[model samples]
Target: MNSPDDTHESTVCPGCRAVLPSSRWPETPKYNASPECAEVAGELLGFEVENAARLGYLHQLRIDAYGGQHVSPDAPRIGPVFALNGLYMFLERGSGNLDVRTAHGIMANSYDDWPRLVPPDRVGELTAYDVLIAGGVDEVESALLKWARQVWESWPDDIRETIRELTVELVPERYFRR
Candidate 1:
């Protein structure tokens, strides 16, 4: 019988389909007894492949909306478009745009066009841009929808709009360099 390590194939780079060795994956912190925390942690870490893929789709959509390229093949290597829950949510920035595995692709977003309503204090060590350009369109929509349908559901319609206007595209601005 195959061991747990051997039972499943190693995770490969979704962008390039590069076969990732077992050693290449991040060493997650040890798991405790609580299955709840483990599940939460996995969700947060983009370990859930389906969820990640959804988020990645959203991320790409947002980039495309901003006139950014979907995939920049020619740009120098930056890194893989991140996946969470099997979704491709965020792409690494390179050549002043989203870096795709393919060659000659250059994608960029208009940072200045984004609103600056996010509080400087709440921004913490991260900037407005950092939070905006981080995830794919689907992931971001999921997060926004979660907040809208769950936590902010009871909020006034105007309030919901206000909150979303500030936080909706947090990834691109947050991650994309000026």
Candidate 2:
């Protein structure tokens, strides 16, 4: 019932065409949009959707035993650790808009003292450090989440919850809770 011009037509990622809301069609999936769309939507939305995709992929891998057998063998793999990595990477490298000012500030501080903030023991578990010299990816993600919540208590509820839910969804028990 909507005219072409009246509706803001935007191309959607084939990856998320079905699940995304109309408003989120062209939006970034990392923030509840689509994984493919995230890369072009800037740090906030892009990284958010990337995190979601990572969560989704991990959920499939661990709890659902799902995956894209067709994806290129050379392509990078996605998983729970990657979700945390994506979240941390975004926090460290994302561009901040006005709405994300506080979040950005928290991210900035974390970025500045990431190594010191997360002790060697913790880092060991979260990054690929042991194998790749980066340590454990889990510790970095957990620390990032903790720091984010502590520094920006006033961050929007749903946005924060989205991140939390995505992270939770990666857990085997909670993966399919929704």
In terms of lDDT, the best-performing candidate is 2
TM-score of each: 0.20, 0.18
What shift in Å separates residue 140 of candidate 2 from its native position after superposition?
22
Q: Residue 175's C-alpha lDDT in candidate 1?
A: 36
The segments of candidate 2 whose C-alpha lies over 4 angstroms from its true place after superposition are 1-8, 18-40, 43-74, 78-81, 85-178
lDDT of 1 by residue, 45-139 (tens): 34224555555434333322211111123322221111110012222232122332122122223122322221111111221122233376554
**Clash totals for all candidate models:** 51, 21
- Cα displacement (Å) at residue 165, model 1: 6.8
Q: For residue 88, give model 2's deviation from the true position in Å.
A: 9.5
Candidate lDDT values, in order: 0.28, 0.29
Prediction 2 TM-score vs. true: 0.18
